[model samples]
Target: MTSYNAQEHHLTSTTCLPKPGVLIIVVEDDTDTAHLYQTILATRYHHVAVCHSGSEAVARLVSHQGPAVVVLDYHLPDMTGIEVMATCRDLEHPVACMMVSADRLNDQEAGCGEAIRLTKPLGCQTLLQWTAKLVHKVQTAVHGEGPGDHAPENLLIGQSAAMQHLRTLIPRLAQSRSPLWLHGESGTGKELAARSVHYCSPRSSGPFVAVNCAAFPEALIESMLFGHVKGAFSGATRDHKGFFEAADQGTLFLDEVGDMPLPFQAKLLRALQTGTITPVGSTRDVRVDCRVITACHRDLAQSVREGAFREDLYYRLNVLSLALPPLRERQGDALMLADHLLESLAREERIAVCPLDEEARNWIQQHDWPGNVRELENRLRRALLLCDGKAITVNNLMLNDDERLTSAPPPSQAPSGVGIHFSPGRMTLRQIEDAAIEATLEACDGCIERAARQLGVAASTLHRRRRRQAA
Candidate 1:
């Protein structure tokens, strides 16, 4: 009986109509309301059935042929709507259910289930829109069509073996309700991977709430995660639903989870264990049902060993883990991703897709993308904007020499560390800069690109500085 708040969910769509073949069953005890629903839906759908009792609806649903969606009233003549839905769970043909009620239901009354629940006094348009969406969702699943927007394959884009393995692993992870741990470097698409898991799961229709653990202050972390009542603190003017409650009947993604304060780890562990949260300034605990997916760039096991994170909480969140490979580790993906990003950006910007020049491709292949996919995306976006109707050159990306040099050795070949010695004389700033740049270039086997990366400057910038010093 987890009621769907229309404002909260924002799931209104009227243009996307359901297919005529899908049957819609309206289960309302009130004949006038039932007639109104049947009349409205019958105008759009070929088959619309009305059932006044829970028993009748269950029998009809269990025996219904082809794809069907039922609108079940929370108060039925024989049984509660959830009970009806739960009983039909074993039906040979799956049916989508929407429970409508005048009375608001709490998470405890019904537990978080797959059925969508909406409060009564529901608008005719809202009812129709939700019913259509549900019908489309069921039919789409049954016919094996790709889901809208957040398809796992599209979200996790790459052809490398590592990516192929992830494509296989993500769906399997989605099938379970256990806590999921996504370990990856920054910009490695941990949140995207989490999203893939959510869209691929039974809870796709519900909210997918993401929280950045590091973004919240230490003092407010508890209240942000568990909510707060009115007048809880200074500036507490109203009751606030926290991340956990906001993500009920869906997924809660905690990104950069390693940065969560150690003291709060204990409370998080308790919430995960008990499936409940006690909001700030509230004495009673509210039950919540959501799949908790957590991501961190650093090693949690190491953090636990160093006592920065809780050992027990680590185990709790790490029930099932998926490690995303950084962009640098996924060989041959950099260029492929570059093309994809360019095309996507072009479409978004309403411009023609920009091609990468030979030098740009070489630089992309050679440079170490420490920021992973995010850095690549950012650089490509910048290049796309500045390329000015030309193929994107290394200069456009600001990562290579002004006069493009031969492809440099991969970053792995660059020296791990470069040491510079300043002559004992007090040197000007320009002299110091030149000495450091020379040392880095020498250490990188005279590869300007590698030297620039090491020196934290554009290869073109490094080349210009070196030439000026020589003159």
Candidate 2:
């Protein structure tokens, strides 16, 4: 381990591109392979360090001296690369990671979908190019320059005041060791904000473990958060290290925090307070050093008031909070983000960068993006794929002129006789309601819940109204 850092280090790329003391850690199990990675990184980036096992790599990460790019091997002597990443969740300064596997593993299988994995039998030039790019991005970010300037398509890309304010707050939150709660509409990039905080903080070298709280089954959440000893349950064949333990010295991003089961909130609160988690079927409590970052689309404060959430837990989690502005509020940002997304999509698909038509750009600007960046990406991706050539027209996005209305007006300001429009548009309120309900239901593919959401009413209300209309 000591010999790893004894080698002479460079601070610039082979092309003389200034990299200024960037540290690139290559974690590999084999001696020859580790040396190969070291040689490749030394050619392109400055200060390369090699580690043989997972534990040694983690130890190197914890002692990180500056901005870094970690090229991790999937299999190791003690723990898997994913496990090591999990352990580094709370690193103070954000580090970029590239997982390498000899066993034909992809990024998803490596449990780090955000970064793609390189297959075994590494390409020296390919590895150097990727790591150099990532290192440059990380260094640029650490120096307090606006990241949006470099990649406007990044999830955090936005020049709007709301986004700028968020950029300022990220470091503040990262500097403090406080549990953070993020509230935003779906697709507004809550997890992005969490990652921003993690990378800006001192714990940026640790794993950044993200879990969709709502994605897990109610019965399994407890075991998932607190590791379960083997035989704790019928299917518990081996001991499991839950989210809390995995996130030690890092950050555990609990997305959809509002959706966590009611019964588990007490246990969660206890762990947050005590900084200790007692695994299932274990008498011992292990101390966990990690920051808890929670996010949800719903109004958690409202949930607390409605008694759906524990007040104590709500207050605890809410000690720090950030409200992400929806895409609609970030003026002109949607178009900018769309352009960036399109460029990337074009590159990935091996096609020319598709230009947006006047109508398409207008649609993007005028329309309210209720689903935020996620929606923007999907729409653009669809347009990119469906486009014939040269330009993506409004039709490419499937945005008919009628759907261009920014938002439905308040009930009081709604147009009269929107339904059926029988006898040249003179209709009773009931008739109009019936027509609107019918149209919305059809648009939602007869999904009552979805129709109700569109209609700004409860699903049951939509159901009752639908029944009455049928009668």
Quick one: best TM-score, which candidate?
1
lDDT of 1: 0.77
lDDT to native, each model: 0.77, 0.73
Instruction: Note the clash tally of each candidate.
Output: 0, 19
Highest lDDT: give the candidate number.
1
Please give, for residues 52-103, the per-residue lDDT of candidate 1 as tens digits: 8654565455345356888988887656777667544433234788888898
Give the least accurate 10-residue stretch of model 2, judged by summed lDDT: 1-10
* Cα shift from native, residue 332, model 1 (Å): 1.4
Off by over 4 Å in 1: 1-146, 399-471
